[model samples]
Target: MRNVSSPYLLEQLMSRLVAPDAPRLYTNGQPWRDARGRGAPRHAVETEFKAEHAVVDLSTQPPKPLVVKCLVRELRIRFYAVSTIKNYRSAWVCFLRWYRGPLDQIDQEDIREYLELLVAGGASASEVSVTLSALRTGLDKFCLLRCTVGLVSPRKSKQLPVVMSKKEVQRMMEAARTLRDKLLLTVLYATGLRVAEVARLQWSDFDFDRQQIRVQLGKGKKDRYVMLADDLLPLMRQLWRHTKGVGYLFPSEGRRVDRHLSPRTIQRAVKQARILSGIGKAVTPHSFRHSFATHLIESGTDIRFIQKLLGHTNLETTSLYTKVARMKATAVASPLDRLRDEPGSSSESSGRQPKPRPSVGRMRLEVDPNPDSNGAYAVTLGVWKDGQLLPLPGMRATMPRQDWVSLQIPLQDIWEPTLRCLPTAQRERLESPEFFSQLQREVAKRILRIRDAEPFQALKT
Candidate 1:
C-alpha cells in the first residue's frame, strides 16, 4: 500500500467512504489531521475552555471572568445560586461547541440540532430541558433574540420514588462502620434534608433551645427550618465538641478545612452502608428523604404538616407518600373475611349444626354446540347455598366427552363442604367408599333423567 500525501485527496476519499452520521473520527491520520489543519477543532477547544471555567466543586468557587460571564452576571443579578450559575454556564459552553458557529449567527435550527444530538447521546429528558433553558437564557438575554427553538422534550416518566422501610433504615444505620457515617445517615432520615443541604450545614444552623435546624440555600435557594430530632442532638453535640465547633458540621478532611464536606462523600458512605446491610433496594441519599415523608404519613401526621416539614411547595408532591405509607390500608380487612362468621359468635359456640332450609333450584349441564377441537366440554357449577339464594360463587371444569360418565363423581366431591359442620365421624362415613358409590349412582341417575327431559332434548337438537 502507498501512503497518501495530499490532504485534499485523502479528505475526498474519506468523505466518500464514511457515513455522514458516523461519529467524527479523531486521529493523527492524514485525513483527520488535514481537516484539523483547515481550522481548530471547535469541540476540542470548547471542551478545554469548559474545563478551565466550569466550577463543579461545591467547596471551591471559580475565579472571575467565567466562560459565560454575561450569563453568570445576569443570574447573580437575579439572585441565582452559585450552583445554578455553574450549570447554565456549562450548558452554554456545550451548546457553543455543538453548534460550532458564532453565537450571534446561530438560529433555531442550530438549537434543535444540538438538542437532538443531546437526546441521541442518551441525556435524560430533564437534562435536555435544563440545557434548553440555559440556551434560552443566553439567547434571550445576551444575544437579544426571541426565536422559539421547536424541540419537544421527551415526556417525563411517572416513576415512584424509592423509599426504605423503617427496619431497613435501622439496619443501614447499624451497618455504618464509623461514627461519621452513622451521624450522616441519622441526620438525613431525621430531617429529610437533601444531601446538598446536609453538606452545607454549619454549627450556627443548629438551635438547641428551639430544637430546630436552619437549612440555607435549599433547592430553590430558599431557607427553611427542620425539627432537630432529640435523639440526634447528643451525637451532634459530640461531633461538634470533637471537631472543636468547626467551620462545617461535617468538614472535608483535606487541607481545605474551612469548606464543608462534599455531598458525593456522604452519598458514597450511604451506598456502602446500604450494601453492607444486604438491602437489595436501589437506595440513594434521597431515599432517606422519601422514607422520612412516608414514615411521617404512616404515623398519622397530617399531610399538610408533612409538606411543610419536607419543604414541598405542592400538596400533590407530599400526597404521593400516601400510596407507599404504612397506613390504614395495611390494617384493612379483606372482603374474603366477611364470608366466615366472626369468632365467639353464638352459632360457633352452640355446638349444634344449623338446620338446612329447604330450597327449590335446578342444575343445568350446558354443552357447547361446538365442543373444543380437543373434544372437551367446558363445565360450570352454579350453586345457591341454603342461607343465600344469590349465585355469588361459580366454578368451572373442563373434561373430555369420554369422561362425562365420571363427571358426577367430581360434582358430588364439590358438595362435600355442605356437610363440614356435621360430626367428624358422620362426615367420615359420608365420605366413605360405600357412601360415595351410592351417591355417585344417585347423581348419575338424576343426570340421565335430565338428559331425557324435553328441554335438554330440544337444546341438543
Candidate 2:
C-alpha cells in the first residue's frame, strides 16, 4: 500500500491506480465507455458538466421570479383593496412588458412613451389616468426613486349624464320579461340606488317599518340609507317570501345561493328591457339614477336632500340636475316673448296716429287643491292674454281656498299688459277713488258669478 496511511489518500490513490479493465466511472455514475466500446467525446462531457452545474444553481434559486411577487406582497402588506391590487398588477405587467428593461432602472421618459402609446392605441382618458395612478402608487410603495418628472395625466372630459323621461322608465319597467327584472329596475329608480348597490342588496337591508334601505359598502366604502317607496314594499315582501325568507335579496341563480346577484347581470337585464321598450335612448341602469334626481328636482325636492339620497360627497354634484330638470326647462319665460308687441305690425308714415290697443288680458285668482305641509293651498293669479295663459309676477300666495273659488285681489299687484299699456295720466286716474269704486263694484259682480258657478259649487269644502 503506497500511501494507505490516511483513508482520503488511500481512496485517491485507488481511483488513479485502478486497472483499465476495471469499471470506469463517469460523474453521472455511468460507465465511461459507450455501447460501441469507446469513451464519450470531450464536447459531450463538457455539456454534461455544465448542465449538472445549472441544475444545482436552479435548485438553490427561488421557485419563481421575485419582482412581481414582491410587488404584490408589498401591496398586500399595505392593505390595498383587492380590486386596486388587480388593477395595479395589470398596469405594472403591461408597463414592464412594454418597457423591456429592468423596472428599477425605468425613467420618466419611458413612462411618457408608454402612456402616449396607450393613447395612440385608443385608450380613453379615464383609462390612461387609472394606469398612471397605478404606476405612481407602485413607484411610491416599492422603489426609492421619488422622481415623477413628465408623467402628466390627461385632463378628464366634463360629460353630462344621460337621463330618461319618467314615461320611458315606466315603459321599461313594463317591458321587463321577468318579475325579478321589473323589481330590479323599479328599486333602482325608486331608491336612486346604484346598480352595484342593488345587486349587493340583502333582505336585512330592507326596513319595512321605516320604509328605508340600508346600503353597506357603497361607493367610497361608505354606508347610507335611502328611502324605500311604499308602493315597492309589497313587491319586496313578496320577493322575500318567494326566495324563502333570508339571504341576498337577489341571490345568484342555481346552487350558489350565498352570493348576491352580479352587477353585470342586472346591467344586462336593464339593457335588454331598454331595447324591447323602444325608448330609442342609450338607456342604462345608471340612467335610472339620473332620472330619479332630475324628476325629484322637477318636483321641487330640495337639492341638498337629493344630494344626501344619492350619497354625493358634494352638493354641487346634485345641483347639476337643476340644469337638466324638465320643469325648469319648460317653465322658463323666454325673453323673446317679452320683447314682441303684437302678432302683426304695419310700417306707416310718421304722421299716422297709432291705434289704441285694447286691454286684452284678464286676471283672476285660482285655488290649488293640494295643500302644503301647513294645510295652506297655493293661490295663483293667472293672466289670460292674447290666447296665452301666464302667471302674473308677485301674484302667487298660499292660503286655504277651494278650487274654482275667486277672491277680490288688490289691483296694486296687477302689473302686466293691463296697467303697463295705459298712459301715465290715465293710470293715475285709475288709481283715484272714483275709478277704484267703479273697479271694486265690477270685481264684486265677477266674484258673485264665480262663487255661484256650477264648477265652484262642485269643489271640495
Candidate 3:
C-alpha cells in the first residue's frame, strides 16, 4: 500500500498501511526507486488532477476524493445527524447518476428529468417528500441553488384508519395468556395509552389511593391523568411486588435494571393476540385506544371527560369517537327481518330460523397460595391440575376460604425459586386489606427512588 495524494488539497495522503508517519506521492509501487530508469515516475507535481486514472494495484479502487469526504465530514459537524447524513448522501448520489457526472455542471433540465424519473419509478407521497427534502437540503448546502431539484412535489393519497368492534376487543383480551399480558392489554384499552406511553410508565406514575394514572409527557409531549380501574389496582400491587427491585415497570430481558421493555415486544404481543382472536377486521393496539374512546362515548360518558383521559391536544380529535360509537337499540326494526317481509314475503318459504342462545359458563377463579400481604407466596390453584405439580382445585367455589396468608419470604427467596414455582395466577385472587397496606408502603419507597433517577435529572433539560 503506497500513499495516495489529494487532488483538491494538493497534499499527499499517506496510506496508514505504508507511510505510518510520513507523506509519499501517489504513484505505482516504490515511486520507481531508480528514477533514472526509462519510465521515470512522475514527481514534483503540485496541481489539481483527477487521480482516478492513476495506475495502482489491481486490488481496491482509489479512495474517494478528499473534497467529497470533507464535504460529508462537514455535513456531520454541522449537527446534521447521522441519519440525515446517509439520507442526504443517498439523494445526492442519485442526482449524480441522473446527470451522469460533475453534478455542479448539471442544470435545471437535468434536475427536472431526475424528479420525473423519481415519480415515474412510483415513489409514494411520503417517500417522495423525504427524497425531495434530502435533495433540496444537499443542493442548498453545496451551492447548487441554480439547479431545478426543488421543483418536484410529492403525490397525495387519502388513507383511512381501520377500526375494531367490542366483540373483537373481547377476543383480543382473551388471547393474552398471562396476567402481565392481560394487564398490558387492559392498560392500552383502559387508558387509551399509546404503546410508547405504556412502555414508559413508571411505578411512580400510578396513584393507588386516588385510582388515577399520571401519564408524563404523553403524545404531543404533554402530561395528563387517566382514571385507573379499581379492579386493576390490587393486581398492579401484586405486580409491583414481583418486580420490586426492577427499575422499569416492564424490565427488559437479562435483568438490565435501567432498561425498559422495548416497544416492539409489546407490538408483537398485540399482533399475536389479534391473530389468535380470529378477528376478521384489521386491528392494531391503536384500535384498542380507538375502541376505548368509542365505548366511553357509547356508554354516555361525557365527551369532555374522554378528551382529558385520552390527552388529546384538540377536542375535535377526541370527538371522532362520536361517529364510531355504536348506537343502542331504540325501537329499531331488524333490516334483515324486513327483507323476509318484502313483496315475496313468506315466513315458511323464507326459512326464517330462531337464533340460538349461547351458554355462559360461570366465571371461575381459585387461590393456591392464599391471599398474602407480601404477594410473594402464591401459585395458581388451576396450575395444580398438572399431575407433576401442586394439586388443582376443581372449582373456585370449592377452594378453602382459609383467610389471607401473610408472605414474609426474603427478597432473595423470590429470585432463588425457579420461575415455574412463582405462580402469577394467584395474584388475581381476592384482594385483602393487608395486601393494600403493603402496596402503600412499596409505593412510598418507589416514589423516593423515582425522584432521584437519572432520567428525572435529564427531564430538566
lDDT (CA) per prediction:
0.69, 0.70, 0.60
Can you write out model 1's per-residue Cα lDDT over 78-145, one digit (the tens) per residue? 88778778889889777766654444456788878788898899999899888888877766544445
**Best-to-worst ranking by TM-score:** 2, 1, 3
Specify the highest-lDDT model's number.
2
Off by over 4 Å in 1: 1-67, 149-153, 329-461
Give the TM-score of each candidate: 0.56, 0.58, 0.51
Candidate 2 vs candidate 3, lDDT winner: 2
> What overall lDDT, based on C-alpha atoms, would model 3 receive against the true structure?
0.60
* TM-score: the better of candidates 2 and 3: 2
Top model number, TM-score: 2
List candidate 3 stretches off by more than 4 Å.
Answer: 1-122, 132-156, 301-308, 314-320, 331-344, 348-351, 354-461
Looking at candidate 3, the ten consecutive residues that score lowest on lDDT are 395-404
Kindly report the root-mean-square deviation of model 3 from the true structure over all alpha carbons.
Answer: 23.8
How would you encode candidate 2's per-residue C-alpha lDDT over 1-461 as one tens digit per residue? 35369876766677788887788786457667656435645544431233232211222332223555667777898777777889888887787667665544567777788888999999999989989987776654355333355567889897788899878898888766555887899999998999988988998888888888999988877899999898896777657656876899899966898998988889888887775566778888899999999999888898888998999999888988887777554667677665444445333323457677433235565555544586443455454646656554332233234312222344565554565655566556545655433333333334434434535457654
